[model samples]
Target chain A: MRKWILLLAVFLAACTTKPSFTSENVYVGTDGVSLAFTKNSPPAEVFENSIFPVGIEIWNKGAYNVEEGYALVNLDQDYMEPGEFTGSTSIFPSDASKLDFQLMGKSEISQQGDRDTIGLTVLTKPIDILSEKHTSTVSVMACYRYQTFASPNVCIDTDPFGIRENKKSCTVSDIPLTGGQGAPVAVTKVEVKMLPSKSQDKVVSQFRIYVKNMGNGQVVDASKVADACSSEGLTKSDINSVSVSAQLSNGIVLDCIPKREGNGGLEGYLRLKGEDYVLCNYEEGVPMELGTFKTTLNIALDYGYMHSISKDVTIRKSAVI
Target chain B: MEQKRVFLGVLVIVSLLIIGCSGSKGNQPTAVEFRTGSSGLDVTFPSGTPQQIFENDIDVRIPIQVENKGAFPQFDELSEFTGFLWVGGYDPNILQASFEQGDIRKQLDPEELEGRSSFNQQGGVVLESLILSVGDLPLGTAVYEPTLIFYLTYLYKSIASVPVCIDPEPRSINVKDKVCSLTDFRKIYSVAPQGGPVGITNVEEIITSNQIIFKFDLQNFGTGQVIARDLVSSNPNEGFDWRDLNRVQIEDVRLGDRSVDKCKPDLGEEVELFQGIGHFQCTLSVASIASAQAYTTPLTVTLTYGYAQSQFRNIKILEAIEI
Candidate 1:
């Protein structure tokens, strides 16, 4: 009897020791990113027929990694791309210019922060200005990918004798999983629960997923763009709009819809646990006589995001004329 | 010896005569210096002003004028003041002197003064007359020349302005010298930017016997978008039109201890500013036209408007200069 107990303990330890993957890198949205035109870089007072340098600065204020980050600037005809000027490069089509940069995430622990800058030289075109003054507007847009992470623990138990102290003492299995690969909406947590029914003697598994808005913009219903939450404003249609799903080890997939209140985007649809989450369940017809098994939970969330900034530019008649 | 004594006396007389002539020449009347007041106003009784009058005779009139010879320009509401003229010294039982028209309060008109007087184009002189009536004098009076004194009291004012540049992005450019003058850069002047759209650029004063007029330039210095208070909507879904959202209510316009009763603002109720920078020739009439010497009185202008200012300053936009 003692030998059997020893063997059981060893087996349980082996099954419950599931290997988990370390996620060192995550991509959230650019919400933590900031961009600006450095002071006096573009020459506050620019003269006509001469190339002036405009410097753009970028800072990453978030914890996630951002990739393929770039800024595009739109200006009026009063400015032109440098043709033969030094450090002259054009990244956009007519009426626009682009600047690329790389940055590291801001870390409170290591006290490490990421910031970078790019400079562009553009020719100033002469124009007739009455009252000796002229003003122009420049629009700037940044594009990049960001990510969010959520992780929740689930209890898995499968003991027919009703002799197991807890799921941790029972022989259990773990499967490594990763998602939010192709879409902007990503799921970070996948928790599972396996329990036995007293009367039917059947096994039921429940899955819970944690989701977040990892991008620089707010998450909203993919079907609604104009009505989505953004710097422009927020509406009731923006709440609990994320759709999540889970796939069990048996290949069965379950979906959890956010519980919402009223028709407004502000209340209802239970994603509000301080963290947005959804729950799904799967039940088997009969109890398993059994052995320790491995299971994988796959999650997916559907959402939409938006970001923007504006600057005023003043131009002077070039002294070159 | 008598001849010699007479000759000596004649010599002494000649020397005395010469000294007397020199003394008389030095004592002649020198020019009288008349210092102008800070309000740029000078009130004085012109020549032919009556010094005496026969008691109990109506239609006795006295003429007085106030000279606005200040360096600054005067407007109806800007530098306007009031004046009151009363005839004293004559016994009230024997004489009744007051504004001939029963309008003791003098509302000095700068425009009218400018048109009537040749003193200065910007500021001119305001003139008025006071009539006196007589009560029953001492029975069977043969001759009477009562010394009647004309006492004047008025409110006076002055105004000064300097240039200021409004810039949202200060670091992007050196705007200290970039803009010229605030008054010249913006074509229209408004006193109200977010609150009233009514900008009081300059102030003037005019004093009369019973009331004082404060003439000021109420302008729209900013974008003249004015919204009336009653027309304001509470719907969150509907966006606000900035031009229609600018309205300013005159909470209180006071001078010293008295409040102005008659102030004509173009909008009828609140001051409305629109069409870039609109302007109103506003007038404030106060009954505090008491008798006081040329002095400065506290004038308070309080306004309430849906004051909101949100504008992006392009460092490239140069300011305007009056020069």
Candidate 2:
């Protein structure tokens, strides 16, 4: 009976413990995808006029499901040709047309973290007897849609109302902040200041948001891709075009758009400079009743990312009897 | 049996004869031809040349050629000529030799040479006539050969220049292309400039009213000695003495501004890089400039001295007596 009672108490104590949260918003989807050649079977050598297998491993480490993912192979047509795989097609060196997609998986959801492997078969072209050995480089690329996030908490209070200390009913002190997260773009810093308006019923606040390009991808307009990222026909935009929105705890929404300065358009461009700090202005129509509130700010960033990894293979022309 | 014995005895005699010839050849001495040293100077009397003279030959002139086969050029005049050639030997006992007072210091033109003297090309040569004064020996003195050695001394000067970057302020704008600036002249000029026979090892700068003074130390980078100019000619009273020799002139002080006028070598017009190393100080007035921005300028120094180079020729001295 005592052992049973002790077990019940331990279970209750365990249920009462709160789960810890990440200090920053995590875009688990984008940061989790990793694609590479498997260690057991890498692209090293292939005999001329013969077929060989190349293996690739793709890992999905995000919280959400990958709707579509694929790998494309680029090779020199004069020296080699892709075998009759479903996605493999003949491409010239100068052919800039996007590679035809091979579906790696459909609705592949990674709960904790899961890795998938695929095999690609390739054949080398015939060579002359005088040419004993020839080297060719094959490039492999992975393309997919991903998401990331950044969250920063700021203080919003109306403290100078001359309320008696003895009758103090509200106070806002040091609250732990959630830092910045995501790929390609990250909110490096955020500062907020509230100033009293001359009118008796309103107040104005200024928000300075710092954004940085953390990856090699080109940031572009999200609307053009229809909420999904595409590697084709990628045109870049400036910082002024970045979309930002904020909301108070009382369900009041505020939009902060950047004004054009110099060569930077309405959304200042980073190609001209390297990074940017955007100033956002927000005005409250009604004065707060001497209290503290929690607010949320949303930052939307869109970009086109491309990664090219290559390997060298030698094709030998066997000696004829 | 007797015929075999005879054949064996003949074979033994032939073998002994062959061994005797081989032993004699092995004992013979090998003739080795020595490399006549310029070992400082390679001067020697030509083989088969007559050394003994008759009483009638009072001041007979001998031809001595000095081919500058060394790495450095011998000059006659630093301002105009390259080096001087003086031919005299060690022993003064048996013979007294004299050259023409004015002709004693002769100039060898290095300009006429086909190629300039560098690490690759051999230096030029100059041939001059040497007069030998033979004294009266007792009637039966032993006839022997006395070496006619020659000594050539001249002042050798080496010049080098370093680009000193000077700005009004004390900081280097480009860390990669370090220059001498006002902030730290010692740090930049702590080492010497390359591609010259001489190096300006150390330099110091002092800025005064309308004038900046640069103090420097010069070092010889060659294996040879640097001759002091003042010691070259014995008689300073004579007009041709090398009193003003070994003069180092700083020429073409450029400060980017074409309007920079009166940039003078304030210490003096000419200073000597004495004993391979010399201390030099000069000043330039920067007060006239309208702007005090930092800039780079070149400093060029030219050294002039009567350089000396030497070579040795082997000759055989023969005895010639008149009855």
Residue-wise C-alpha lDDT for candidate 2, range A143-256, written one tens digit per residue:
554333343333444433432111111223333323324344555666666667666545565566666655444344333332222234444452224444444322344545
Question: Which interface RMSD values do the candidates have, in the order shown?
Answer: 52.3, 55.6
Candidate 2 lDDT over B200-262, as tens digits, reads 566666654455566667665543333345434421111122344345444333344332243
Q: Which stretches of candidate 1 lie over 4 Å from their true place?
A: A1-33, A43-50, A59-70, A77-96, A99-116, A157-202, A207-306, A317-321, B1-323
Model 1 - which docking category? incorrect
lDDT of 1 at A122: 69
RMSD of each: 40.6, 39.9
* TM, every model: 0.30, 0.36
DockQ of 1: 0.00
Q: Count of backbone clashes for each model?
A: 74, 23
